[model samples]
Target: MAFTIPENLHPDLMPLAWLIGTWRGKGRGEYPNVPGFQFAQEVSFNHDGRAFLNYFSRSWIIDENDEIIRPAASEVGFWRVKENNVLEVLLAHNTGIAEGWVGVVKGAKIQLEMDQGYSSPSAKIVTAGSRLYGLVEGELFTSYDMAAQGQTLQAHLWSSLERQSEN
Candidate 1:
């Protein structure tokens, strides 16, 4: 596949230009308090000539048949890369969780950690979390580590999603 950068991307979002596409793949989720499960997800990063990239993701828990059993998790967010390579992400989850993450961006790699996060009384408490994302050889790789439910930071989710669409 020919990968070309979108010419209409905002200058501030150039660092995140590679992520301006749809990615889909399968992943596994594991928590010490819950049974391990498989899931499928699609994530999109889009821009409207704005300084930041708009992000959205949807995931579903899948059965052995690769059929969706139920919605697993979803979030909407914005990504921005500032001077000095500081990367910032703001996300809100359907489960009443909102978070701010900050880190560094180098080439097509990003590493972000929770700068602040808040959860509703009914939402599960996630004290901290971190994520690493990179585009290598045309494949998107991502992993998540989180601290929640009284558990310390540990690997929670990971996915190797291929670029499915550039729109």
Candidate 2:
């Protein structure tokens, strides 16, 4: 599909224009000492003619037949594009963790490395993380690796989502 840049989007965000929409898909996740599970996710990246995009994602644990079991994880964040295609992301999770990530956009893919994080008194601390996002065959593919609970960084979640709307 041909993509026309949003007329009011800031110049610096041109590289991220393709992500300005809602995406929905299913993903599987597993972590040490945690049961593996299937999940359905919806992610949205929207903007208000500003220099950054507003991000939100919510996931629901699903049963074997793709039935919704319960709400799982939710996060809200912002994506900013800086000089030389550097990307900065700030995210706050429902689990009481907030993180800062820095990365660079290379064409249709982005790789982010966790720079720092803060955890609430009752939250688990994440010592490190990495996230990859790419436009693959018109679908958005995402993978996240994290280190927490005394475990080293490893694959945590991955999903492929199709564009649902242009919003």
Q: Each prediction's Cα lDDT score?
A: 0.91, 0.95
Model 1 sits at a Cα RMSD from the real structure of 1.0
- How many clashes in each structure? 0, 0
Clashing pairs in 2: none
| Cα lDDT of model 1 by residue, 1-167, tens digit | 44567888888877787888899988888989789999999999998887888999999999988899999899999998899889999999999999999999898999999999999999999999999999968888889999998999999999888899896
Relative to the unseen true structure, what is the Cα RMSD of model 2?
A: 0.9
lDDT tens digits by residue: candidate 2, 1-167: 44667889999899899888899999999998889999999999999998999999999999999999999999999999999999999999999999999999999899999999999999999999999999999999999999998999999999999888887
In candidate 1, list every pair of residues with a backbone clash. none
Model 2 lDDT on a 0 to 1 scale: 0.95
Against the true structure, what is each candidate's TM-score? Answer: 0.96, 0.98
Q: Tell me the TM-score of model 1.
A: 0.96
Runs in model 1 deviating more than 4 A are none
Cα error, candidate 2, residue 29 (Å): 0.4
**RMSD to true structure for each model, in Å:** 1.0, 0.9
